[model samples]
Target: MPTCSAHAVVDLDVTGATISKHLYGHFAEHLGRCIYGGFWVGEDSSIPNEGGIRLDVVEALRALDVPNLRWPGGCFADAYHWRDGIGPKQDRPVMVNSLWGDVEENNHFGTHEFMALCELLGADPYINGNVGSGTVQEMSEWVEYLTRDGDSPMVRLRKANGRDAPWKVPFWGIGNEAWGCGGHMRAETYADLACRYATFLHNHDGNTLYRIAAGASDDDLTWTEALMKAVSCLGCTSRPRGLFQAISFHYYTFAGDGISKSPAIGFTDEQYYRTMVKAADIDRVIAAHSAVMDAYDPLRQVGLVCDEWGTWWEVEPGTNPRFLYQQNTLRDALVASLHFDIFHKHAARLRMANIAQTVNVLQAMILTDDEDRLVLTPTYHVFEMNKGHQDAVSVPVHLVEAAPAVTVGDQELDPLSVSASTKDGRALVSLSNLALDTDTTVRLDLRGRAITATRARILTADKPQSHNTPTAPDAVAPADFAVTTRPGAHGSTELTAVLPPHSFAIVELDLA
Candidate 1:
């Protein structure tokens, strides 16, 4: 049993504001129906779409205020050739997807369709270029086609294909997951390629182009070190930025849970503990990634974007395995909420992150079947619940000691997650009780500031594996939180809220 003061205050020393808008960012890949049927359903169909893009799905993502979207692929980005997917859909060449399901791509959704989707959702388009299968000339032309104003091959192609104006895609990636799917190149090799690819990238003034270097996999500190050191010193003449706006990292929560990894929660102690352990590791990965950046450039310059992250369990069996879709439960909700806290706590260097998907792909925010849709996954509720964290400045907190490390399989976790902030003079305390069971309560004490109403919203399910399917849409969802009165307690308050077996709750306090 470990205990200490849970008292804390908003220190004015931390001036950096947390970029909350980014937490709502999402990932869109060329996998399965994620892009073709899931997002781009074609204008000719009677499925009620906006010029081929699913209108209802668009509306749902819009509601979440999705700020940015990474496109052209996940691993697919590595092999993607922008030219093949542009010009004319009829003329666009069809290719086989070697990385994902080995499916045949019809080239139906191209630059115009992706750009159009970005416009409709009011999100920034972050395009991952094909470093493994594409050349420097190809990457350069793709950027010019979208961001360049005057005549260029890409611009001319855009006009000839259909559109006449530039789409202004400011965010571009030199490569994606290069170490794995992009290309199994040494960090040294990838670093040189990044410089070369970024050299040809050009965007109009007022529109900054971010050329992200493909970063390391989980715990690959050496990879980050090698890339950071190589790029910081290897300056390019044409592009002075030298491919250093940000470095992209991809990670998945796969602890060998296998087909047994049903819902994110509701497991034997082994299952619950394993899921939480993986979720807790997020902070460590961020810290290590930031540390590597710090060593290279002591001054905070290169940002770390965990561009892709989500639980990857066996596809819910009989369904198309390529969908990469799974059930989102309370455990999943907590995983998402906790990750938000992790990134928010390290906002200075960890600038951007996107859940593996937005809809019907991986740990999606929204799931759809035909015309019917349900927020479905607790992940959706978690994002909606933690909306307060979007763009809010980070506030420091001193957490009292907790029971020593909780072990799950071969690993251990901190069990307690906390991230706090004050925006527009309002204080928000986001807590994720990573503990599997036996409530671990915190007697929150605000020494410097006075708090008024402590309103709370929670996403909790009775069992860790609890989930919502199309048939029973309301299985696990966010419910009104019951806050307790102070009773006879003076100059103090308490809210004894059950955190569900494995769930996340956001507590908002109106401080006077």
Candidate 2:
């Protein structure tokens, strides 16, 4: 039997990074039911809807305070002709989603629909332009269509269709995954093409387009260097801040080879440990890429955008393989919490991260059935619980001899992971106990901040495979957490929390 008791001290005075709200962002591509049935069900559907979009989904997303939504594609954006999807639904062109699924894309939910949905959710829209198969003129016209306030052909067309006013699209991706599905082009070639497309992508309606060049996949430093160099050369004779403000990086956590990933539920303990290790690799990826960016832009003028991330598992049993839909479980919640902790720790280099998807897709926050029933997955609760870390000043914490490692075969993994933030006289601490059999008692010493009140919300289960289904939707959900506290000798508050195995928790403290 292993006794899982850990002692750690957190200093309130030690603070550095300011966690951007965008770190809690989400991604929605034109893939699977993520767009069609998952979000857009048409105004006449039997399901309760608001302007063709599901009102239930909208309200659920609003609860997360979803910061930004990347749209038009994952691989779909590059081949997507925005013009085809923008007009009367009857007149819209039908196209095939070649990369995602071989199914037909009924251009019903196009530019206007996406922007409208964003407005309803109060989330910013991050559009990925088609640089792979699209021309510079096409990209320019698309931006002009959505954002141009002055008189223009695209604007005239937009007005004739419906919307009288132009929308403000702040974040723009020159291309997505240029090293792979985007174009299969080398770094230098893609960089040149990105510069050309970004050149014609102008600022519209007093809205500065924050252009992001397609960036590295994993630790491919050359990709980062080449893109940075290209942008730097363009910046020398161009504006002081140049065109591209950020670089996009895409990383997905799947341990198995190729598309054959681990199962979504009921995996061995060793398999679970390996999955957690792969999830934590984002920190290393960000650090390596940031160092390359630092070499070129030492002022950290450009930030890193983890536009595509999340666990990709084998599709749900009998569904279309290309749909990329998988059930969310406690493992996913832990993985999400780990990524958020890493993102919060590296807030300086990382400005934003949009999980691979939002609904009915890879590691989705919400899962829906054919009967219009919705289940808030374990990952959803993690985001809802840790939402306070958004835009909050990140308080650094050091774990001192807290607990031993969980040894599985040749791998060693820490049992406790934590991240702290301070906002409005409140200290928010997010924790994860990563062991499979032991529940660790974490003794927290709030060094500089005095606690007046404390409350915690935890997402856990009796088993690692515990999850929500339509039949049992509340199988693994958040519940009130109780902690023991006492006044320490040095006028510090000592708090003791029992973190169960494979659980994620958010502890909030009101400071006096």
Candidate 3:
């Protein structure tokens, strides 16, 4: 328990990349209560719903300015038939969710319900198609049904379902985890299938699709290389650009041996440090995949989509094991901040990222109970504070005097994480102190701009494993932070603040 010191510099004029808003997107799957009680409470229920879509959930997510939402899957998308989740709820078919659990899916929340949810939240819909068991024609018609206008079989079906105008669907996924739950196909075989599927996923009525192909699991660069190689045209004057717009990969962090994972709470200090090491390793994972992509697509035409990424832990005791529900803690918030910092650094190639299931699931922003109660998790506050970075210009942050790295067993962990961006004549600098028991004072020299005023906020709790429940919803939340300002070398401004251990903070500057 010692005091640490660090120094960093932020250059305002050296901005090149605009952080894509889609990078802050979210994922929703049809697993356990994620769909039934988490989002959809049924129209007849007393929880105050709109078209069977929970209004409270929409209201909570709207505050974060959700950019986009991926639907019907992680693994469920590959087995889902778009036709099942549309039309009348009473007449819709019921199927057993074999992937997550053997629970019967009543098809209550389907295509129209999902679109309604998106409209309510004003978020773009990114649909993942069924590639494992669905046909090319089936996938093609689903697009037509969702986005096409004028006369057609799909349009007729849509009109019969009580929708007149075509919805604006921007992003689509060819499949999900083709190496596993999506299908047991090899990388080469999936690549060929992806090409065939992308060829037929046509743009209808001026609605263009950014189709993403299912990519590697963790560090399997061969999967990414195979997808890029399949789309690239060698020995030709120019390569194709629209065969597939992007590729996706999934990564999850845990601290346990083999399939077992550390519990969400009551974990030891060693387990906590080990999880931080695993979370921070995403930087290496992204760099490795980006290198492979740069070789195949030198011009950076293809984007990287991390559609599934978050912390996975043992399920809450006494809950359905297949539900994938775990409490979000202060440590989870630090992990999120670390990921966003790394994501901002690679904004040039990384276009979109959706955190693994959004509500009542792995590292969710909001957790709810069977009754009319909800609690915003610590991770939710991180998203709200970092919302300023959406679609903003990325500024370079250089650590002049780096923080001392903490050694955990055989792994070394950098306890200080930082990222900065500017938008609307204001600059936002996000920092996190990952050390478990040491306070850190950070000095930030602001270059290329004159700062007029500054405001700061921080999120932390008594312990790293501290979480919020229905009784103490505000146990872990954000509060105003104090900072000192002075003159720096070469007529620059200096901002200094003492960041608490295991905390995340953001400084907002009014740039002149």
Candidate 4:
């Protein structure tokens, strides 16, 4: 456990890759109370909801400015039948959500409810179609019901259900984790099915559908290779375009052993370090998969979409075992900032990534209690602080000095995680100090970018495991960060800031 100062060299002039706003997307599944009690509490409840959706949760999510929301499932998407969930509230068939908690799904939150929720949050809808237990025609008709503008059976049924105008859903996931819960199909088999599903998926109201195929699980590059090859083979003789726009990948960072045994709260420093080590492993996974994708798509036309990802730990005490519920600690915030930096660096191929969920699930942004109570997690603050990096050009950051490694390992984990972006004469630099014990004061050298003024905000806790609860919601929140900048002796600008241990900060600079 040695201490070492870290330094970052940022070049504003040498910049490329515009970070897509969709990278800050979120996920909402029908698992647990994520829909029933979390976001949808019945309009008649005393929670002050709008159309059975919690207004407080909606306002909190709106504050995050969530770009896109993937709905109806992780594993639940494959088993879900859209038709069963639509129609009258009471008449809708109540089915068993066997994938989640074996809990009864009342089918109240159907397609109409989901699209309405998207509209309320001002986020684009990214729906996951059922490709395993459902048929191709069923999936096509569901898309037609939502996106089709012309008069058709599906559209007419949608109007009869209540909505006259069609909802614009640009992104569609052909399947989710096909190699796992979706179907457990082989790489080659899933690829062919994905291409076939995309064929019948029609565009409505001139809305171009961004069809995404189910991709690899962790380091399974063969899946990406087979899927891309299958998609590239489409229209080889007749046309020249690929069938899929992007491929989806799902990776979750589980603490302790890779199994489902680790607890969420009350963890030792060793467990915390191990969790971070797993989080950093995502960089390696992305690199390996991106290289495989390059073999099929040398032109890099198709984007890499991480539709499902986050920290998955054991369920909370006394909660449903199948419901993946856990408290979001400062450690979770560190994990999130680390991924954001990685996504920014790989913005060329990594266009969009959605955290596992937005509420009442693993590493959620907001958690709700029984009635009229909600608290924002530290991870939520991380997203709020780093939101400025959206749609900004990625600037290269070179480490001038090595950062101290975590006590758990000798390998350098890049304790000083840094990413920079510049847009409209403004530059933003996000830094995360992963050292759990020691704070590091670093010197920032902004190459070819003159800084006139600067401001910052930091999210940290007195302890590494500090988190917010319903009773004590303000336990961990962001405060105005103090940073110093002045003219260097060599006629260049130099910035210095002290990053507290296990903290994340965003520095905004006014460039001249």
Highest TM-score, which number?
Answer: 3
Q: Judge candidate 3 against the unseen true structure and give its global Cα lDDT, from 0 to 1.
A: 0.91
* Residue-level lDDT tens digits of model 1 in 5-64: 232233423546575576567899888667876787788877788878989778777767
How do the residues 156-207 of candidate 3 rate in per-residue lDDT, one tens digit apiece?
9999999999999989999899999999899999999999999999899899
Judge candidate 4 at residue 95 and give its lDDT: 96
- 286-361 per-residue lDDT for model 4 (tens digits): 8888887776676678899998888988888888878878888899999999999999988999989999889989
| Better model by TM-score: candidate 1 vs candidate 3 | 3
Per-residue lDDT of 52 in model 3 = 88
Candidate 3 clashes between residue pairs 3 or more apart in a chain or in different chains: none
lDDT of 1: 0.73
Point to the candidate with the largest lDDT: 3
Each model's lDDT comes to 0.73, 0.87, 0.91, 0.87
Clashes (candidate 1): 11
Model 3 TM-score on a 0 to 1 scale? 0.98
Candidate 3: stretches off by over 4 Å: 233-237, 256-260
- Candidate 2 versus truth, CA RMSD in Å, comes to 2.0
After superposing candidate 2, which stretches have Cα over 4 Å from the reference? 233-241, 256-259
The estimated TM-scores of all candidates read 0.90, 0.97, 0.98, 0.96
Query: Across residues 1-512, which tens digit of lDDT does each residue of candidate 2 receive?
Result: 25588887888777778999999989988899899989999989999888799989998999999999999878899999998988889999899888887889889999999999999999999999998898999989988898988688888999998988999899999988899998899999998888888889999888889898889887888888888887664324333248688998888886634334678885777778888888887888999999887777777778899998898888889999999889888988999999999999899989999998999999898888889999999999999999999999998787876778877567667878999999999999998998888888898888887899999989999987899999999899999999888997588999889888888988899998
Q: After aligning candidate 2 to the native by TM-score, how far in Å is the CA of 302 from where it should be?
A: 0.2
Better of 3 and 4 by lDDT: 3
